[model samples]
Target: MIIAQQKPIKEIAAMIADCKKVLLAGCQGCVAVCLAGGDKETEILASALRIMRKLEGNPLEAVTYAATRQCDPEYIVPMDDLVKDVDAVISLACGVGVQYVAERYPDKWVVPALDTKFIGGSTVHGVWEEKCGLCGECILHRTGGICPIIRCSKSILNGPCGGSQYGKCEVSKDVDCAWQLIYDRMKALGRLDKMMEIQMPKDWSKSRDGGPRRAVREDVIIE
Candidate 1:
């Protein structure tokens, strides 16, 4: 899932300082799971902003709303009626969700409330760790299910680079060496022979080098 963190309240306030009325839009998706931009979070932010503005004698009117998913057009359509009179909208979703809301309401000013983190999963309450690089290619078949692209500091395909020591990364002792982890995993699985296969250089073109990418299902498309 896409991970994100909410922006500072001061920064958010500055973004819509000129507006008297604004909408705080939240997503009940990944951001919600991460506890950054959910229904509860949206209401909290709105209340905080209202209190702060009121104390300052500006008195902002912040309306809170949430969608099943801000990234989906269908889920964001309901916000149109609520946003019609607001001067700006603060989206509490990832980059995709913010853009979706902006694209759906072209005339309304749309602002992001969260900083999109990465493709990761929650390790514990309030802690998320990146596990994937989303490189548009998959090579877990050879690496014992460990991702070298994201886990390796240098993204080395054939590594335990010279920097590895005591199964830890040179970048930091707290970090595990990606290749070392792979070697150990493969060894335990009796697939150590697979580690000997020289990996070819990764194809960069399959990644974000060109521009935005799209995956279309022709069979599912509506004529």
Candidate 2:
């Protein structure tokens, strides 16, 4: 899932300082799971904006709405009429959701309300840690399911980098060495021999730096 964090209240205040009317659009998707831009967060932001602007002697209007999923056109379609007259839209979703709204409503000004952080899984309630880089090439099979690219301080391929000390990352003592974890996991599973195998250089072009990536499936395409 995409993890995001809400912008600061003061920063958000500046985005709508000149607008007379604003829409605080929320999504019940990834942003919701991260608790950054859900219905409750939207309401809280709307109220804060209203109060802050009122105190500034230039009161403004802030309307709140929570869509099923801001990334989906079906969920955002109903907002077309709503945006017809608003000054701007503050999307409380990830970058994808923000772009979807912007592309669909080219005439309206749209601003992002959250910072898209990473693709990750929650460790516990309210705590999310990144686990994947989505590099388009996965090596989990040989790496004992541990992602060295994202978890390791240095994205080393074959083994721990020279910076690793005492089975911990040199960059941070709290961080467990990704290669060390992989070694232990693979060894315990009777797959330690896989570690000695030389790994080829990663093809980073498959990831975002190459260009806009796309996946096609003939079975899923409509005529």
Candidate 3:
């Protein structure tokens, strides 16, 4: 899932310093799971902003709403009436959600309330770790399910590199060497021979280097 962290309150307040009214739009998608932007978070932000504005003698009318998903157009349709009277929209979702809201309401001011983190998952209650680089390619089959592209400090396709020591990364003592993990995993699975096969250079054009990317399922599309 896409992870995100909320921006500071002061910074968020500054974005609509002059507006008397604004909408706090939250998404119940990935941000909700990360505890950043969700139904409750939207209300909390709205209340905080209202209190700040009231204390400054510039009272604000902050409206809060949480969409099932801010990324889809169908989910955003419910917000039409709520946005019509608002001066700006503060999106409490990932970068994609922010853009979706902006695109849906072209004339309204749309701002992101969270910093989009990365494609990752939580290891504990509050700890999330990045596991994929989204290189637009999958190489897990060759690496025993460990992703060197992101887990490795250098993104070496075939390496423990010269920097690995005691199964730890050279960049940090706390970090484990990604290649070491790969080797161990392969050995345990009796697939060590897979590591001996040389991997070709990654085609980076499939990644961001090729600019914006899109995925389509022709069968799902309705004419």
- Model 2 Cα lDDT, one tens digit per residue, 1-223: 8999998888888877779999999999989988999999999999999999999998979998898998878899888877888899999989998999999899888999898999998999999999998889998998999999899978878668888888999998989999999999998999998888887889999988799998889998779
**Going through the candidates in order, what is the number of backbone clashes in each?**
0, 0, 0
TM-score of each: 0.97, 0.95, 0.97
Off by over 4 Å in 2: none
lDDT tens digits, residues 162-199, model 3? 99999999999988999999999999999998888876
Better of 1 and 2 by lDDT: 1
Stretch of 10 with least lDDT, candidate 2 = 153-162
Model 1 agreement with the true structure over 130-186: per-residue lDDT tens digits = 889888889998999999899999988879889999999999998899899999999
| Off by more than 4 A, model 1 | none
- Superposition error at 33 for model 2 (Å): 0.6
The models' CA-based lDDT, in order, is: 0.92, 0.90, 0.94
**Candidate 1: RMSD over Cα atoms?**
1.0
